[model samples]
Target: MPLTFTPHPFHPADMPPVTLITDETDDVELARAAHRSANPARGRIAVDPTPATLTSAFLARDILAALGRTAYAPTRAPVITAAPAWRAVACWFIVDGIRELTVLRAHLLTPERAEQLSVLRELTGIRLILLAAPSSATQAARLGTCLAETGLTDGLLRLTADDARAFFTRSLPTTTPLCPTFPLSAAPVSSQPGAARSQYRAGQLAACTWLARHRRATGQVPAQRDLELFLSRLTCLSPDPATTLARIRGAQGGFTAEGLRLSVPHALATAQGPGLSTLPFTARTAHHISRAVPGPPQLAALASLLFTGAHLDRLVQARVDDIDPDGRFLALPQPESAEFDHHNPPPPAWYAVPPSARPFLRAARMFRQLEQVPGHFHLFSKSFGYRLEALVKDAGHLIPALSHLHPGPAWHHQARLTHR
Candidate 1:
């Protein structure tokens, strides 16, 4: 439903009947003309023609003085709360019985700021939105026309529950991804350059190392979820799980039974090093993995695998059957259920070895291995695909068009480069 405002109740005495003047020579017009004629004393002004002088504060002050006097008024202006920059000039038109003021305010506006103004107008029922922006006169004039056509001052506002759903429904493009990028493999700690020591890079390095070690130990791949948790822990940055998963899917690489692998560009690999690795992973503090990895798609994929594995291991060990469809899965509380405590977690779920879940389990174990051996020469991209398929089998139903979107090496590289 269109949003409407209930006008405040008005006693008959609160509002006076608007006076109408049919003739052009009305008192208001006469008053304005008389005021203008009386103020016709000419003032000579000189200005330096140089570029520096043109932008000088003194010149700006003089210009403001001249403009201000010409547009001066004796009447007190009404106060507007949360007025958008573009609407500052049009406030007079929005307020009933105030159109004769002819007062104009100088301001600037940008396209993004203008959109913000529109959104504010929709959210608030205020008319005569006055803004103070530094936009060009032509741009302001165009915006004024847009305001009028859109009825931004007078029309009912539109509201929606979920902006994302609304956007897709209306065929609006979603925001561009902003995930971080890093090198393909965890670089050696001793070989780190000054720039590589950034908190982000450090986290990526730690995550990569963790994944590589896990892969080597388990002879399997890691899932996207596993990578996500690993990175999150290393960086101490947490992103929405669903959103992170989506970005991982969009990033280049795939999960496999052997390890999480990302296809690194020949250029990047040559420039940085072979098989990037992250931090040394320990089971005791594995929960620290939640930081995001920044890099090309392949790096992003590896990071996702590392971080997500850490998170899933904890979650799975906490309550095994929570995700299992069959009734065979069991929940074992920590410090209470010795069967799945720190010393001994329930043997991998029965389904872990089955055709349906075996691939995912293998990927998970590979991520664990990567954590153990931070230095290893592995086929990064091939590992990524294998892990990706496993994650799809486990959680593909949670996303839209999971089967249709296939991320390429270029896409991964572009995702990393642009994001970084």
Candidate 2:
């Protein structure tokens, strides 16, 4: 799929020629042909083949980086100096709304991050995109609030199926049309409606696979509502499933009566599980975590449980001041706010140091050297639990007793058991 950016608002008189940024090499050729053929006055349109996330900061850095490589003279418009690799065959950049790229308000961008973009914009003269999809009225309101323009909204043209198809064909001459004879299905019936929706793109691939298999077995495409239900359920894993479904439904604008069939790429369409290693935890499993974990942070974090029954978050947030090195004791912090989980409130203010103090001290000493007043430091990274869980899974293969523990539950169970 082509790397698509949200359209920005701009005036024709002030607008610079459109530049397509993509990680796909083939897209470079396609975009070049299309843009040049469409308008010679548009000047030389450059299709950047870089793989950086199209955030304001990253794009600003990329634009500045590209300035050093090309012989092109610097102009008022920003220049890209570095670009990331993309696997896309063809991508596009449109002249419409080309000046200020818009970020979907539904993403719930933090105010701090938005201010950072404002700083970058002042430095680079590149306006950050702040548009939301028109399908969402609430999002539109939120976007207005973010921009301090509550009255502003861009009207979206709802195109007919034929109009969309015509636009698509004219827009990219290089795109090969999916042949009608292809035994492809767009949406699939999910066997596990109750199953937690995986990732967005993952669910789409799975749904497509299910649709293809169903067609092969029953010789009929599923109803539209069925597809909608599958997507609604599948997208529940996302922050806004309703918005996600609306986006998906909006993309289905061109689906014909026969159903919109697509060629599923090999890598993405392949069925895969959560890819976590599985095994139950035993004392031996705990030992594996201790050994497999190669850092003081992880070791110190795990060893803390041996001395005190603190929860994972509490132990990680412990600071140097919380430790009484000479007294052979540790103090867990109280919750800063009353909004603690009812089931797992704050631990006691103090805990006796365990026999594993040698390594804990080593870890603590190392942490102090890094930063003297390291307040509320973490021993293990956010992902450490998953890594430890995976280690337990790998250990299960060799140790028969650990084989019964499923990695998902086993990880949580071990975490809960830390308090005991």
**True-structure Cα RMSD, model 2:** 26.2
How far off is residue 298 in model 2, in Å?
A: 0.4
TM-scores of all models? 0.18, 0.23
Q: Compose the digit string of candidate 2's lDDT tens values, residues 1-420.
A: 111122222332333221212111223333333333232112111123235343443433322222211212222212222211010000011211122332222124334434443332332223233312233557445534643331112232233333423433454433332211323432322323522343334545655665667678877665433443333233322222233333333323222222664221133112111111111222332344443332334345554543333444455566655655342555555554465654776443444443334334344434343332344464343324455454333223242212323212111111110001
Scored by lDDT, model 2 comes in at: 0.33
lDDT of 2 at 384: 41
Error of 1 at 418 (Å): 24
Query: What lDDT score belongs to each candidate, Candidate 1 first?
Result: 0.27, 0.33
After superposing candidate 2 on the true structure, give the runs of residues whose Cα lies further than 4 Å from its correct spot: 1-290, 336-348, 371-373, 379-385, 391-420
For candidate 1, the lDDT comes to 0.27
Superposed by TM-score, candidate 2 places the C-alpha of residue 55 at a distance from the truth, in angstroms, of 33
Find the number of clashing residue pairs for candidate 1.
Answer: 100
